[model samples]
Target: MIDKRCSDTELVSLYQTGNEAAFEMLLHRHKSRVYTAIYLIVKDRYEAEDLLQDTFIKAINTIKAGRYNEEGKFLPWVCRIAHNLAIDHFRKRKRYPEVTLEDGSQLFDSMRFAEESYEDKQMFRDTRSRMRDLIKELPDEQKQVLIMRHYLQMTFQEIAERTEVSINTALGRMRYALINLRKKMIKNNIAYDENFYPKRFDQVSIPRGQQGPDERD
Candidate 1:
């Protein structure tokens, strides 16, 4: 019998060596998180279920073909596959949902920029647009951390688990992401304002229950 406490790395290794039960264990352990990730994006239970199955099927095929190299970081790797599949699903349908802020602003989160004039708001919008472009210029690891934390609204601990890194590593990546973004902003002649963007990960507000009072790097 396979130990229920077996690590993901152990389960993956056993599965690679022809133990089908190990693969099943892996699926059982991670299925909920994977499904949730898909559901959050697709916002449809049936569609999330279908994509979840497709995700594991793709992973199974890759493992069978001896191409699985993710090793210890199994969950994050699988989550990324599911994320891509969900994105592709929307792309194929050509109907992407608009993420809105509390005040009905589209695409941008509920960040209150202290703008009092039409010109200021328009400048803020243009800055945000350029910021998105700058984000694309970040290194893949940094970009992934940034998107997962800011856009996905994931907690640091959750980000660490999904990215298969320590909390400090996740926090460090975010810090560097902000630094890099600020550098790009200066290079592009955009003003850097801490009130508009988080200059540090710790300054970003954590949801009430998502983080403890003592949680920090």
Candidate 2:
């Protein structure tokens, strides 16, 4: 039997060895985050559910084909697949879907924003929209690093591995991404304070202070 406490990498190894239960454990562990990532973009429960299944199927296929080289970084890899599929859904439709309050409620639930007042919800939506636009305006490498770091919440090591760059390059791209985003935020009059932006957005626009000598760049 697969131990429940096994790390994702271990489970992935077991699955690749033809132990199906290991894959089930991996799915149970990460399905919530993966689904949330899909729901945030598609904003439709049924559609998100479909895409979530597709995401895992694609993952399973890649693993079976021995093409999944992400190793310990499985979640980010799968999440990127889900994100791409969600974006493709919109691309095929030729327009972004309008998010309703109901859809927003589900998104807020996943994001822990469900308790805010109606006004705060509206502000959150607007802020997210504006931030997306600003992010799209960024240069490709900077934007890619920013999304992996901020959106995928990947560590510099993981980002470096995924992007095939040195850790320093990943850090440099993030620094420039934040600098450019801050400039865009100010020029567009989008407040980065807690009152106007989510804490996540604040992190993207403002670099945190150096915590210690051991802190990674």
Give stretches of model 2 more than 4 Å off: 97-151, 154-217
**Each model's RMSD to truth, in Å?**
14.8, 11.0
Using TM-score as the measure, which candidate wins? Answer: 2
* Residue 163 Cα positional deviation in candidate 1, in Å, after optimal superposition: 16
Q: Across residues 36-81, which tens digit of lDDT does each residue of candidate 1 receive?
A: 5565445456777899999999999988898989767777788767
RMSD over all Cα atoms, model 2: 11.0
| Candidate 1 residue-pair clash tally | 0
